[model samples]
Target: MSRRPADRQRARVYAWEDRHVAPHGGDLLPFTAMQPMVNAIWAELGLRYPPAVEPLPRQARRLQADANRLRLRVPEQLPSWVLLHELAHALSSTHDGASDGHGPCFMGLYLQLLERYLRLPMAQLAPSLAEAGITWDPAAKPVFLDAAPAR
Candidate 1:
């Protein structure tokens, strides 16, 4: 569960990722449409008891809060990749039974979500993680009782 290397490697691997993409496929998400998309994903992943969604205030560049809530900088732009990244944190923590880690479990679930929901190929994603010395266990995955709702 070493943090630094995995964090650096995750960034390296996703460096090509755009922060935003059209939710329905096209260019980046338009400003007016961003909040709904963000909230939608937040609710979708929150599972049966989805947490409350909050607006990120203007002053904060970062935030500290419990896993029971999702916060977004609404009315401002948000990238799809950023949304997925934060969602992975919540999903991994919830599934892995650990509060936090950038280790295999975290990145594995991150890549899983990307591959599953975004249709990114793991053939390209997994190796770069290994090459960068990130221990990624493919078994690190979230449990779904049935098909996940279409994003």
Candidate 2:
């Protein structure tokens, strides 16, 4: 069966997370444990408010821009990168616009936040996205302030 792009991205992020998580001794990293980090990323992006993260009843991750929150399928066991991915969506809506989807603009925002705010290296994330066939704009600039929304 063919996999959705998001599923592919999730698998890649999860694998990378697994390799890095070994030092923590296999304990599950809960969303609460990662909230501060997510908040920091949100603030670093100069968002007016931190995105709200909550568990969705269904087994699928969703971004609710109008509500200014992320509806996660499994909040308790969310991987750090996945949280960052959702945060990118939140920031995109806040700065870009509520109508933006997963396009070049979104991809650029996602990469910038992941690298600058979440501290994931481009050397690591870029290859992963390439392998997953997710195209992004290398020249896409990240928002550094709330002065204006990005295009």
Candidate 3:
């Protein structure tokens, strides 16, 4: 089957991460600490978990991609919620076999998982996301998935 737009976009993000984000201090982030959380979310959502976590290069700016894994830029400073946001993307992509494009479904599921796993309310999560330059608006354009064409 042909790859979906979301899949391609996800790949692009991964590429960006690999080339620009991984080379810096990205490895110092709490990757191990985040694994269990990611797995838990994946199990709950019934998604295939990625085999491993790898660091993307560091020059990554607004856009980045990692190796079929999570793709995120390393901010000069990162907030705790940033981890959760990327985790949500990873889980959603794995479970659905397609990127949800950070849309309402993705955000709704993410918020639920965040509350359950992190014990943080949506209100609390929003500010942290905003602080990290992550968008809280579900209607915002997603980086990965897009609407499929009508047959």
The model with the greatest TM-score is 1
C-alpha TM-scores of all predictions? 0.58, 0.54, 0.45
Q: Candidate 3 local accuracy as lDDT?
A: 0.48
Q: What is candidate 3's CA lDDT for residue 142?
A: 27
Better of 1 and 3 by lDDT: 1
The CA lDDT at 45 in model 3 is 54
The candidate 1 region of ten consecutive residues with least summed lDDT is 64-73
Each model's C-alpha lDDT? 0.52, 0.53, 0.48
Rank all candidate structures by their TM-score, best first, as comma-separated numbers: 1, 2, 3
- Ranked candidates, highest lDDT first: 2, 1, 3
- Residue 17's lDDT in candidate 1: 40
How close to the true structure is residue 102 of candidate 1, measured as C-alpha lDDT?
57
Candidate 3 local lDDT, 1-151, one digit each (tens) = 7766543233443343344333332433355554554466556655453435445566665543322234333333333455555665654454235665554455655566556655656676565445444334444332333433457
lDDT of 2 at 92: 47
Top-scoring candidate (lDDT): 2
| Residues 53-106, model 1: lDDT tens digits | 355566755542223123333324445555556556665554323433555666
All candidates: CA RMSD (Å): 7.4, 7.0, 9.8
In candidate 1, position 82 carries an lDDT of 54
